[model samples]
Target chain A: MVKPMTKTKFLERLGAELGIPPATLREEAPLNSFKAWDSMGHMSVLAMIDAELGCEVPPGALQKCKTVGDLVALVGSKLES
Target chain B: MITQIASHLPRTVLANEGLAQLYPDWTAEKIFEKTGIRERHVVDEGECASDLAFAAAERLFAGRAREADYLLFCTQTPDYLLPTTACVLQHRLGLPTTCAALDFNLGCSGYIYGLSLANSLLQSGAANRVVLLTADTYSRLIHPQDKSTRTIFGDAGTATLLSKESGSRLHSFVLGSDGSGAEQLMVKTNGARFPRADGLPTTTDESGNVHDPACLYMNGPEIFNFTLKAVPKLVREVLEKAKLSLDQIDLVVFHQANAFMLEHLRRKLGIAPEKFVLHLEHCGNTVSSTIPLALEGVITTGRLKPGMKVLLAGFGVGYSWGGCILEW
Candidate 1:
């Protein structure tokens, strides 16, 4: 079974992917608030979630994901189940 | 066996800085950082994919077009719907009357599809020599204000020459398509099913990408999801059929969809970075030509040497996927 991922670790990894430090990544911050979170960044995050986490982020979640916490929850739940 | 590979990129370039200037929201460096593309070559207003393909073939031929016995052209952007572009190329390239030519429709998975077609003809002795050309101008199909596709695709053409020695260096191939994902990445209008409507409505999604029936539309996330599932399976099956292992591959060249996607896929597959080739930094995603372009890029640097075992995987557009092991 895949180990359950925590919100802290998710933030760290996502921060690294976007080249930002984990400490600065506010969980409730809007993804659009960051300059790095553009279309290309969006795809990179999806790729990272799959390649690293071994979890397929549902494509439709791209529309629903507005905050960093939402993405963390979506991916975290995928790994737990 | 495969003998020669050559490519042509148009003179006009759509650099990232120019695109950022047009969009205003995206900066040049941000565009380059994530996509790993600084610029992409685009065709002139009147130029076409066939022209690019012809130029590539001429580079390969060097006035020796008469040596070809078979021609295969792959494209979604054909020069015309009536006369096959391959027929036009056969004539323009001065191939002999005995040469047989035809066109096949595919996008990202095109080069190896052409390779498979060429392999059969060479193995069957139907032709002693073959000219495989892949060309596409996705720039022609993009709506002016569409930022997503505008930043990603470029126009290009590639020519790969293969001879009767296909039994040796050219190894096993695995090709598959799932039409269920067909609408995910396609051009819907101007075909018999959806004829072009003069006043057809165009819509824009949350991404600020405009959608018009006459233009090319790509659901990027869905395509990526499909690729993640299909490509690894393709690699497994191809290696199994070829009776080889991942460690045995000397080089790996996949379709250069983008730097970010390719890099992640390479890491996921555990292929070393140096072994996996990326050539789209200068050309962007040239659809069908991405494979051959990567191959050609390595050939120039002498990184792709003779007698090396190379793995090629192409997945996208038609939800079509293909993989093969070549003993170079």
Candidate 2:
């Protein structure tokens, strides 16, 4: 059985992948505010999510996410489903 | 067996700095970092694919214009739809009137498919020598203001000579296609389904790139996703058919789509950096000419040696993909 990833764990992993401090990733932090959040960065995020969370997130999913919390929720929903 | 290869790039050059002038938000450094393309060759206003193909073939004929029993020209941009471009090339190159010639319409994956066709011809005793030519002027199809396609595509032509030799070996090919994703990378107009009509409005996308129904359109994310799903299967199939493992292969050459995507594919496949061939910095994606151009680079640079096993794979435009192994 696969265990659901917690919000704390997800934030930690995402921060590592994006090279951001976990504390800096506030709930309402805008995704575009990050200097590394470009097309290549988006691909890295997708690859990291698949590698760490075992969830396949499409590129379209990232486009729909505006804030850090929204991205976490997207991945969490995929995990739960 | 591929005996000789020659390529021709147009004289006009479009540097990244020139492109930066069009899109102020993106600098040349940013563009190069994103695409690994510093510059691309652009054809003159009146230049066509046939013109470029003729130049490349002429270069190969400089030493000696040997007569070929057959000529196969691969391209999407032909001089005319009625008469085949290959037929025109035979006359332009001064080949015998008895030579057989035809053109195949494909992009990106055209090189591998051409090799497969040429190999089949030699094996079946259809032709003693074959001249496989690939050329495209995608620059002509691109809108001046469209940065997406403009930054990634360049104009080029390549000619490769294949002849039968004792103990020459070419492995079987593994090819695949999924037309359901065809629209992901295509020109919506100027074809049979959607003929070009005047007064078509131009629309701009979120990236600030303008597009007309007649111009080329590409969904980067969708193409990337399709590649991710297809290339792994392609690599494995070719390796299986050749009875070789990843470590046994000396070189792996894939379509020069972009630096970012090619590096990602290399890492995903666990291929070593030295074993992989990447030459897109000088000329951006030349569609069908990419593989042969890269092959020419490795050979000229002395990286590809005799007795080395090379794996060639191409994927894109038609959502088409193919793989084959060559014993050099």
- Candidate No. with top TM-score: 1
- Could you give candidate 1's per-residue lDDT for residues B237-292 as a string of tens digits? 99999999999999999999988788878877889987888889889999999999
| Model 2 RMSD in angstroms | 3.3
- Off-target runs (Cα >4 Å) in candidate 2 are A1-44, A47-81, B166-168, B197-201
Model 2 chain B scores worst on lDDT over the 10 consecutive residues at B163-172
Residue B80 CA displacement from its true place in model 2, Å:
1.5
TM-score of chain A of 2: 0.81
What is the TM-score of each predicted model, taking all chains together? 0.90, 0.89
Instruction: Give candidate 1 misplaced runs (Cα > 4 Å).
Output: A1-3, A11-38, A58-81, B63-65, B165-168, B198-200
lDDT of 2 by residue, B1-328 (tens): 8888899999999999999998888899988988999999989989989888899999888887668999999999999877998998899899999899999999989999999999999989999889999999999888888887899999999998898962446785999888887887788887787787467788986556788879888777667767777898899999999889999999999999999789878977889999999989989999999999999999899998989999999999998988899888
- Candidate 1, which CAPRI tier? acceptable
